[model samples]
Target: MEAETVSKKWEGKVSAGLPIPTTAAQVWPFLEDFCNLHKWLPSVDTCYQVDGISGQPGMIRYCAATITASSTSSGRDETMIKWAKEKLLTIDPIKRCLSYEVLDNNVGLKSYVATMIVLPIDGDGIHGCKIEWSFVSDPIEGWRLEDWVSFLEPSLQSMAKNIQDALLLL
Candidate 1:
């Protein structure tokens, strides 16, 4: 008899929702652009199309984010710019949903897949929606599930705020 080998990939899933004071219809346009994440994510410095077409699967985007770390030995704030290559997976305009997966990233999380959806909700006659951002990825080597959740919460909050602000400017 031949011996069989099994491999396991530890996965972590987390989501965060931000209530926006706008309708899903209004939010869909911004979310539709695969390489426009930098416009809404405050942490992202820039996002450019690397390959394929916008809004299409297999479209690769290079996204760079400016991150600030704790103070260094000299007491000056430390900042670093990191980038990632991500591929668009699927998008459903009618459903106001989009998804993408990370191909390579400077931060080192593996097999990261993320989805964002805009959902309509009754806001007492106010046109409002909830932006839900979720991701499934191989757990960070030394971090727990809660740590990932903490890392994501702020980014989602910033996106929600920026989206609402952008819509107001239009």
Candidate 2:
């Protein structure tokens, strides 16, 4: 009989971001639903929330098929171990600033605490939103800050933009 085989391999990280035209509340649902991760994120081949229970912390969110900006490292898998925290951190709707961790494989760390600020920008006829995700991640993964951004930002930012686009259809 053949023996069962499993492996746990951890690599470095990358991060990036893009601007969008939706408020945080409008984008929050898409971010909260772990199953919908693939819809917005470009590189995620698979993802699921570990604790499906509502309002559960340490609810795991994992992913795969994340690669490098150079387009190197084919088949490089990435994961985001996540939890949902509400009001645990700073979330002032009037201020449009919040701070919390979205977990790994975000920014190539086992954990990433992103302090994202959502500022409302005025256009000619509408109030748009500007999002800035700046965070500090664990350095244990042997990945540089630049590398962390590379591993993370593309898909996340992609989803953010997609969410904005979807909202426009409504």
Candidate 3:
């Protein structure tokens, strides 16, 4: 099938409340494992090391994080790329907070920032986690604003659902 290129400046987040019987520190590892992205991200088919570092600056990896309504002429699949530019700005394990950025050249983002904040919700003592996602990016050459949102919105929504579901199951 022919591939329709997708380029966009997107900034969005997909997070849900994870049930914790213990401390927020306990679940931090699962959230931080970069290679374990597919476990939390439903759209992700597989993730592998391409080159450079991972979960750090100048890290290179390929992620098959694509989905399609049907497996037909037009579909989405992760491209085997050189690298994903996600430089960790800050990672507060105790607070369950992380900040990252990706540039256009490496990951193809004119400008982008993604922050994940995890905090306790209700004092049920059972431990409730809250994740807040934020981002912004410049559109790519073949990518447009409208299509970008259209492409990412559903993915983000599903991502949130998958994360929540994972928590439920695990």
Backbone clashes for every candidate come to 0, 17, 2
Q: How well does each candidate superpose onto the true structure, as a TM-score?
A: 0.83, 0.52, 0.57
Give candidate 1 regions above 4 Å deviation: 1-21, 71-76, 122-127
TM for candidate 2 is 0.52
Tens-place lDDT per residue, model 2, 1-170, is 97756323333333233344455556555554545556877665666555434334344445555443432466555544333322223445545455545543433344556555544455321464555566664554565556666756675567667777788889
State the lDDT of candidate 1 residue by residue for 1-170, as single tens digits. 87755424444443334354577888888888878889998888899999997678889999998888788688887989889999989999988898898999888778888888877766441647777777877766777777778877887888878888888999
Candidate 1 lDDT score at position 165: 83
Window of ten residues with lowest summed lDDT in model 1 = 7-16
For residue 149, model 3's alpha carbon misses the true position, in angstroms, by: 6.3
**Candidate 2, residue 38: CA error in Å?**
1.8
Q: Which regions in candidate 3 have their CA more than 4 angstroms from the true location?
A: 1-14, 19-23, 51-58, 66-85, 104-108, 123-127, 139-170
Residue 84 alpha-carbon offset, candidate 2, angstroms: 15
Best by lDDT: 1
